[model samples]
Target: MTGKIRGISILALLSALAAPPALAQSAAPSTAQPAAPQAADASQLEEIIVTAQRRQQNLQDVPLAVSSLGASDLQDRQIRDTIDLIQHIPNLIGNNNVGLGSSNTYYIRGIGNTESIATQDVPVGTYVDDVYISRQNANNFGLFDVERIEVLRGPQGTLFGRNTTGGAINVIMKKPSATAGGYLEAGAGRFGETDIRASMDAPLSDKVLTKVSMYRNRSDGYVRQVNTGDKLNGSDNYGVRGAVRLLPTDRVTIDLAGDYVDENEANLINRVDPATGDRIATIGITQGALAKYFTGTKANNEVGNSTKSWSLSSNAAWELDDLTLNSITGYRQTTQRYFIDSNPAAPNPIATGVSPILNYSLHQQWSQEFKANGQALDNRLNYTVGFYYLHENNWTDLGTGVGTASGFTVSGDRTIKNTLDSYAHYAQGDYK
Candidate 1:
């Protein structure tokens, strides 16, 4: 059993090092075994491995511009979510667009998707364990128990297909291992923040291994309501993940994993007037008399969000003499319900029978991919060929109507529903 708490702040750091060359020494020619090399120090850079080409390879040999962060590197940098990567990744800009509690808008090289509609396509694609994430609002995953994150720049259309016009962000999770070990971590910071994280790995049999992890966090809002003293823009969330690995034979391996996330957090809009650099009032509230403009509000504070998401995936691989066969299958679903203050400069929602703007969305997607990687021509040529299929269903509703103390009695609503199916066949080969 696992438990979680949500909403905390994170900080990060980056460092660089320069190493001087070692002096050469003259030695007499001898047929004796060479002396063992000295132990490497901090100046020696560690070798980095990546799967940017759908196959594990040295980072320096991928023949593409890619950045990677390992688990230890992420912990050292205090990276908590996708948004935190902006500071560390080059030519990247990311943020949570107003109103969505757990969604992300990302731009790479001046290309991105701002609209959350179902028909729109994200120029930058996001993936986990080779499974494609089809929605923008569904890609802002909280980082925990991550093995590594790889950011590939420039167009990757030939391999990644559509939505790769900008680039791709691939997140790899830590898998179940034969070792039985785990860890627990707790932390606290300003704004009444607290967090707890725990994980455990257990082996069920000689060939079966399982791992589970959970996290919870909570924090007070950065913005406050002057009259009610209520916090806005705070977080309350928890999540859990489980993975199982099976090795039925020496040449075959299978992995199955699942995860779920829940968030109940406050959302507030804080806009500034660029001309005067003062906070703008909403719903006929005074211009600046209630409280300081920076972090104070006087509007009705009945806005918040509820989000839930879950996913399941399976991966299998079979090794052959000169080739490898792989299959990846995944399914995901998300539901988000949120409301926002719509009355700009009218009789406050309290006086008028006006309701807040209500927004809701439900999304589902699944994908299947089968591929083979092999070398030919005396091991001088390497190739990958694959077939892919994707299915998606999405629903969205936006409405406004009469307001009540408990909730809005929506009288008007606009609903949209869409379904899509896609298929592709691709092949790539490299010769030396």
Candidate 2:
């Protein structure tokens, strides 16, 4: 939704306070699918805009099970990330892989991926700015600068993809406005916690507009190491997003956006001995390394995890009277690395030390989509047609020290890579 800045747009301002993504306001051209209301008595309640079918319609009018949370709703609830909303949404579970930062497993309606391996697939699909995130390692991030979130339960294999067999998490980012205005905010809390968020929207000439948003958060953590006094389960992360929109003609609109995020946190430990409620002291793990891995309440290992990622996207639309043509292009890259404290309490051990075991996962993807939508039969018939293509490359590297309980040590390494391409052409129509 864009145009005349008559009075004040409260939704825009409130959304700026939270700084959402620059998701386009219009829907992609796709077949008409039945809408199902995830909420009861939706028609009697507030009218929510829905796009589960790749067409804009009211929540109550759609024939699919869907739920939505607007930007203001998320901000009022102080929902900063996916983990915060998981508990509130029914049947939606986003596990952080027992304290690993880069591992996020989302279970919607109890049908998500069970394996933590990077080469596997996720039943529930997640999208940001209409671009499929595909992998969970990059799915868990601060939901700052968002417009709204739509949760569709059940198989969404029609318009989305096979990965959406369980459901889809649709995220729309706030688009840049022709109006020139912005927002800033800061806060502090317990455990040395602090939050800083800001966003700015500006118009360059009559046809070009741009917006930039960023946020930073940190915490001292509640748990600590018994031996080294190091804080566990703490976070230090920052992210930034920028976009430029150009109206080259009366019928054409173009948008280019880029985003980057860096996450560094002390992961929660994964394992603890049941007998003594203590970490298994390994013969190869040092006291300090062992302490760091199992320092906190949810102990697993000594070394935490770190991740860095970036993305670029372009969306263009052309209106041809009653018919509209839309195109989307996207590219993304992400990397995650984590380590664990090896136990030294083996039956036979001469050297007691902590083994540094680490794994690095990387993902790169590019996608293109073209769509056409129009109406016929005295405006009673609505239809959509689209073509989609995606190319993805993923790899993993595992590095660890192989050792025996009898004081043995050897370095081990392994790497694997895979490439995949997908294509689809779809069309559907409905008569009112």
RMSD of each: 10.6, 14.1
lDDT of 1 by residue, 1-432 (tens): 122222111111111112122212324456877879878797966889998888878897889999999999899999887778888999988776455667777888888887666779888889998999888765666788899999998888777878888899999999987989999999999888888888899989979999999989888766543334456667888899999999999999999999998976644454454565633323222222211211212222235666788999999999998899999999999887665555544333334433355567889999999989999999999899899999999997765555444343545567779999999998988999
Residues 1-432, model 2: lDDT tens digits: 345563257667877866544344124454767556566765677778978888788888888888788989899989887767686677787777545655567788788885555678889888887788867775778877888998889998767877898899998888899999989989999889999989999899779999999999988765544334456567888999999999999999998999999987645543354655744322333223322323232223235677889999998999986888889899999987666544433432224344555567788999999988888888898888899899999887765564433343546556768888989888878899
Name the runs in model 1 displaced over 4 angstroms.
1-37, 40-44, 226-228, 271-302, 341-357, 400-412
Model 2 global lDDT (CA atoms, 0 to 1): 0.74
Angstrom error of the Cα, residue 347, model 2: value is: 16
lDDT of 1 at 6: 21
- Can you tell me which runs of candidate 2 are displaced by over 4 Å? 1-44, 270-302, 341-357, 399-413
What are the lDDT figures for the candidates, one per model?
A: 0.76, 0.74
